[model samples]
Target: MVDVAQHIRIFDQKPADELVPKRTAAIKDLASKLTGPKDVDGLMKMASNLVAAAKFDKKLPEELAQEATASIKKQSPAFVREGRDLELSTIALLAMLGAIDGGTKQGIIERLNFLSAGVWLGLSFQQPNKESRIEALRVEVLHAARDYVARGAENARERKAPALGAPLKPENTNLGEVVSNLRASVERLNRNAVVDREEIDFLWWSVTKWSSALDGLYDEASAYSAAIAFGLDGGARLRRMPLDVHKHLVLRRIRAAEPVSLAGLIAAVGDDRLRILTKIPDASTARTNPEIFPVMSSLLSGSAPKSASKDLQSVEAWTVRALLEATALGLINQHEV
Candidate 1:
């Protein structure tokens, strides 16, 4: 396997402060050589050469220099291509300078890989066929949201435990800011109405659901690991799970006359039972958990409760109604009886 950590360090660690000017000058000299679009290939070659020069001039390790050269070769094409419309060339040059200065050559390359994919994917979805384009973008948005949520949950798990003398600080993942940014993006996208409204709505709803789930997980220490595992598993499942299966899940919730909040659903099944349902069972253990299986089956199959307290019932009703609206809006598909 590629040594990702080593690669990350190639760009992440900053160079000596006094050497910064020399690094900047070197990058600028290379950038100045690119006269036009046709010069992109030559410019990439020049960047590789610069890396080689830096190994000796800056006393950088030979391995780091080689990795940096590889990164420039791999990421320079995309930067050059995008530079046609935007100041991507300048941006790329500046990034390269920073990578060299910071010794994060591999990190810069990996980041550029993601950036290149995003740029091309965005352009692809901006085609004339609006319906198909919107659908494609929706899938991308879903995957992005899932990845963000799972990564956030995982990070929360890895947070260091406070010392005995220290007060235990709450886990602060900066999730609120992230959610705010997502909402702003959704609002901006909605203003032009370039994409399907239903697709945008679904994206917005997913963001809210994820934010709420993360908040709940952050507050409950005992449930954190289980919830994070469930979320990560669900995100993985979403990628390959059939569209029909998702429709079925949504349809089951929609069929309930009363609302069914996620909390209510959890309560009905019990947390331990819900946790078991989310878990992947080994072949030997799968059939042995007969009682646990029925709980999951019943939770999915049962209608909304009629006799719950007014407050709980209200929450349930709101939840179910939201699903109904989502189905009607085509955010969630309603399966025919």
Candidate 2:
């Protein structure tokens, strides 16, 4: 199994106000440790610890996050030489920091490319294994789709639309006539190949989300937060995650709404095959109009709201709840922002 970062359990029971002073001291201590090492092994271990700590605290200093992001990117080559495990670890670090730093779309894509390579290599080591082969095929399809789009963009650039002589009727017109048509086609294809525009928009929105909470732009924090949630579920041990932070963000919002029973919440979330949790008609109607999907609606809305003090104090609930609290902190940071 892949060794993924674990969310730090410290201060899990503390209120937001009480957590502040502890978080400040912890960051200060971690920052001090960072000053001691520049070696690859040391850096990897330190980064893992830093990420775990990050999962615990939402409002880490922007300058510190930026510094951590740069260090991880710079050390990518060394990590690659180490092995697949380390490379994956490095990618995780970059993904977390990139989101936190509100890094450019190009930066996130670069880390994703590394992730694809690492996953492919890991699967290669397990070749001839039944499960690995099945998983490899899925990765192959994504790669093919990516490549096809890239090729289409290149072809469009190379083969300009046939020049029409003089002014021609609309039926005879080519893409070049509109000026923006060819450019738009190439851009669209490139975007499809490289990344989705909606996701890029979400990344920026997450930056805004974090920035508003921090009283300054701390972009990509939700990306990191999503990663934290995924890691908690040990999803890293299974396969690569699609870069869709919005679904996870919506899940955080559902959690923010505060359900009474943790087990029931997970069960309701499990039935979301088409991701109805993120959609309104399917999930919300359970609250407003419970007859639509009785099983889901009932399970989702059955329990009355419980006070934070009344909620379960188990590790699983605490960590999941903390993610909600961390995200909600940004939403309410106005007078506090």
Candidate 3:
């Protein structure tokens, strides 16, 4: 039998203003407590207290929140040893609470980092021998993040919340190497290659990490690309993922290729491949119809100039091509209801 009553209880009963005068000292005390040894249950209780203190105290110093976020990340590595499933769930809940009520954009991003850490923990559980736990955590974390992190971001945006932060530019992260590594992995997979566990962990972790970053930047289309790469066909069982998530994954995956050249991109993945991979009825019609594929026609016109970074493209063009490539390689598939 299990009870989450303690999980939901108000663990910190201090008045909101109780810590105002000594917030720094209070935060230092909590941070010190975090550094000491603790079991899973103790850690959970401590985490709850940390979150409650912040939630109850609207004026909780931002320093406490930042320290809480950092502490969670530092502690995340223990998930595998301590049992990742429960650890991930608890950490996610605490992180979400902090994120939803956080007063600063940086704070929300910090919590999102914790969610990203949870995703990594789930991936780490993917061992060849432990198929059952791996699959269970995969489904659970995917849906949980979609529900808690993704929808939370969407809802915050819809409400025009100030704490969601100012609009962000894509990080200068050139995903060229990442894409190159993925292409090599696909080739190896095509040849029935048996990769070591380390490679598997690295590749999946890299994909999840980048996808989570894109999600943080609100580049849902590009991020969806990486997500599909991680999931592939069997992952289609993610019932909550939308159908339209199909097209964009392909575009962004290919766009991140090493050379980052427009001509190379076109030559590597032409319009024909795009149509076949996407299963679009008419490639030209889809491209020209701005409603369906805005900026796509211009991208395929051969006259469109490359952005300075070469990895940059209209978010509209990103959806289709990456989906196309991943589908062609048989790594990803269209979402099915």
C-alpha TM-scores of all predictions? 0.18, 0.21, 0.22
- lDDT, candidate 2, 168-201, per-residue tens: 4577665356665555666656745433444444
Query: Which lDDT tens digits does candidate 1 get at residues 1-337?
Result: 1122222223435444533443344344433332222322222233333222222223333333333333343434332222121122222334333332332222111222222222222222122323342233233333442343234323322323222232233674565765666666665555335224433443444333232323333223233222322332232223111133333433332222343343454454354444433333221121222111221222333422342222333333333232222221121111111
Best by TM-score: 3
**C-alpha RMSD for every candidate:** 23.6, 21.1, 23.0
lDDT scores of the candidates, listed in order? 0.31, 0.32, 0.33
Q: Provide the clashing-pair count of each candidate structure.
A: 10, 4, 11
lDDT of 3 at 178: 57
Residue 176 shift from truth in candidate 2, angstroms: 15
Question: What local lDDT does model 3 show for residue 269?
Answer: 40
Reference-based TM-score, model 1: 0.18
Those runs of model 1 whose alpha carbons end farther than 4 Å from true positions after fitting are 1-240, 245-264, 271-279, 282-337
